[model samples]
Structure formats: C-alpha cells, structure tokens
Target: MKHLKKKKKLLTNDTFVIVPFYNEGKVLINVIKKLKNSFKNIICVDDGSNNKNQIGKHKLGVFLIKHPINLGQGAALQTGINYAIKKKAKTIVTFDADGQHSAKDAIEMIKLLKKNDLDLVQGSRFYKKQNNNIPFIRKLILRVATIIANFFDNTQFTDTHNGLRVFNLNFAKKINIKNNRMSHPHDINKLVSKYNFKFSEYPTNIKYTHYSLSKGQKNLNAINILFDILISQLIKK
Candidate 1:
C-alpha cells in the first residue's frame, strides 16, 4: 500500500488579516491597532458606514476600502479578499470588528494553520466555553444548525457560525460567495466541504459585550437561513 505524503507548513510572511466593518468605527480602529502588531498586512473594508466623522484619519497600518452604501458583511469580506489577492497574500484571516475576537487567538490560529498545512482554520467558541454568558436558547439553535450543516456537507464542525476564520488565498478565490448577507459564514463551511479543502479548528475566546449582543442576529434569522438552504437545495435539484 502506498502512503500519502504530508503537506508543507505555511510561512509567517504569507499571512494577512481582513476586517469587515459597517458602523464599528472606534471598535474597528482598535481591532486594526491590535492586529497590526501581530500580522504583517491588514485590510479593512468599510461597508458604507454613515458616520462621516469616523471615516477619515485611521492610525493603524491598514489598507482601507470603502463602499458608498452599506453592502453587508459578505460584500465587505469579498472586497477585502480581492485586495488581499492583489497584494499577493498567501493566506488571509477573516476577523470581526465587534471586539469579540482576540488578537492573541488569531496568532495561535495562524501558527496552527501553518503547522497543520490546512487550507482553512476556524475558531470554535464552544470548545471550552470560558464565558458562561452565551444564552441557552442561542446555544440550542446553533447546535441544531450545526447538525444540519454537517449532515448536508458530510463534515464535522464544532462551531458553524463563528466569524473568526483563516483561509488560503487559492481556496479563498475559489469560493463563490453569492449571498451578500448574513448567510456568508455558512456558505464558507459548505464550500470548504464541497471543494475538499483541508481544514482545522482551534478554540478561541469570544468576548460578548452589550453592544455586540444587541447587534447579533435574532433567533428568527436561523430559521431564515434554514429556509434559504432548503430553497437552494430545491433549486439545484
């Protein structure tokens, strides 16, 4: 029997961070500053924030792209991905601007991605659950959604909705992210399984603030996502 060869590890200089923003002006600034100290390149996509005062004069060393109107997180992410490709980024890390994800965790994810030779790395908040503040109802919904997503994709993933993830440039370019709305995270996982990309997961802390909790998607959105998925499957059939 022939043995499969192990893949090579990723390099530090090849990694870049992408942050999608809407009205997270000050929070976005803080995220960029923290990420700058760790990652070599950082890209910020302004998804048309109406705050004119917060638009100009950002201090962090980041490549900023702005949309005239709010284009949603998916569009902002796509913009950042395009910029990353143009800049010749070998690996791109997607980060949240809501101050939920930590810079230290990002560094660890990058290192793990390199060591494991994975095409994508996802952060799983439920792995340890250091914070007990996560609502029980939300947890149940996420669990059900994760089960459905795994069944459809034929892959096991602990956390399906976490925004903190890293992807290789090639794999990132191959994804057809049509949904410019809240369903992009699920799309990413489905694509990874569909494309047969190598992926891994790492535990990370998700700090929940009052603002973030308020801004988070409602429970009804999960039902909407399920409906969308069902419609998509039907259309394909």
Candidate 2:
C-alpha cells in the first residue's frame, strides 16, 4: 500500500498584514479588498480619522482598531503589530494604506523571507530596473535619504521610504518603532543596524495614481523627518 504525503499549508494562512492609515478616504477600502484576496489576517489601524465612514463597514475576517486621537503612521502600525502579535501570527507584513503597494509583491516578499530564513524583507521600487513612475522630486528625495541612511547605518538600500515589508515574529517582537510619524522609517533603519537583522530587498511594483501621489508625503517633509531623527538621537545621547 502506498501512502499519500500531506501538502504544505499556504503562507497567507499564518501571516498577518498591517495597514496603517489616517483620513484615507475611499481608497482604504479598495486597498483592504485587494489585500483580502491574498491575506487571511488583516489588521486596519485607523489613526483617528474624523470620518469613520471613510473605511466603510469592516468586512469579515478583517480586524479594525481605532485611536482616540490622531497619532502618526508609526503609532498606527505599532498598534496593528501589537494586535497581530497577541494573535500569535507567524509572520507580519507592513503595507501602505494608500493604493500604491501591490498585494502580489507582498506575497512574493513573504515567500522570499521564508525561503531564505530571513528576519525581514523590504520592498524597493528601485531594487532593479523597472518603471515605478516616480516623480522627479520624490526620486531625488529618496535617493538622498538612501545615501544618508546608508552612511549612518552602514547598510545598503535602494529605496528608504517604501512602506511594503515582510518579516517574521522575531523581527516583529524585536522592533519597536517610536518615531510615531513620518520619521518611523529612520527608526526602523536604526533598529536594523543596531540589531544586525538579517534582511533583503525585493523588487516590488508600485502603481502611482494621482490619488496615491496626492496622499503621499510632501517633498519638504523629508527635511522635517531628518530633523526629527537628529533630535531624537541627540536626546538619546
């Protein structure tokens, strides 16, 4: 008699996707729907949006968490991460609430993370030669930021501000993003450097629509993020 072998379980089943948003209008719903097609555990953290109706009604299998007042993206993401950790998620993904990130790319990143036994896998719009349709000023800002981050952290990364990332419970438990605002990326980079986390960059697709661009960070805000990080570092010293 021949015995049958059991098939491997789907990666999406044990993974949790965290989406942090503030006043995201109708695009948030569409983003959640797209993620739902691939991810079973979805956590949407609304950072005190005045219009609670913006996300509309929550769908089945999706968890919604709200803040009393508007915190920042970092705070919202931390909230979602805490919830997912409490639920015993095997993996966690941080995704932008704007309609720019692709669910397909996230799935691929998760696969790479598991296959290589990596702690974190970050999505890079400029990882390889591809058409991300990035605006000129935004591209310049990211390039400069990447250079500065690499100089200080001694790490190599093509894009510093991309919000798409996948990681396992080890990273989720070890990282604590305190910057609470646009500077959280800097905080993440600092943690990665300090802990020497095993990480890789994956080429991901970014669809920059007018709506997404409008919702993105302003060009000048990059300066403020730098200032915030510098001040935080000074305070630490």
Which digits, one per residue and each the tens of the lDDT, describe model 1 over residues 73-190?
Answer: 8888888888888888888899998888998888778778777888999988776655536788888888888888777767788888888998887688886665677767666888
Write candidate 2's Cα lDDT for 1-237 as tens digits: 111111123334678999998888778888988887777789889899887645545644578899999989988988998999999998999999989999889878887998999998989989986778889888889899888777766678888788999988988887788889998877776667778899999998988898888898888989988887778777874
Clashes of 1: 0
Q: Output the number of the TM-score-best candidate.
A: 2
Model 2 misplacement above 4 A: 1-8, 11-13, 54-60
Choose the strongest candidate by lDDT. 2
Cα displacement (angstroms), candidate 1, residue 186, comes to 2.4
**Residue ranges of candidate 1 with Cα displaced over 4 Å:** 1-13, 53-55, 128-132
Task: Please state the error at residue 24 of candidate 1 in Å.
Answer: 1.3
Candidate 1 pairs with clashing backbones: none
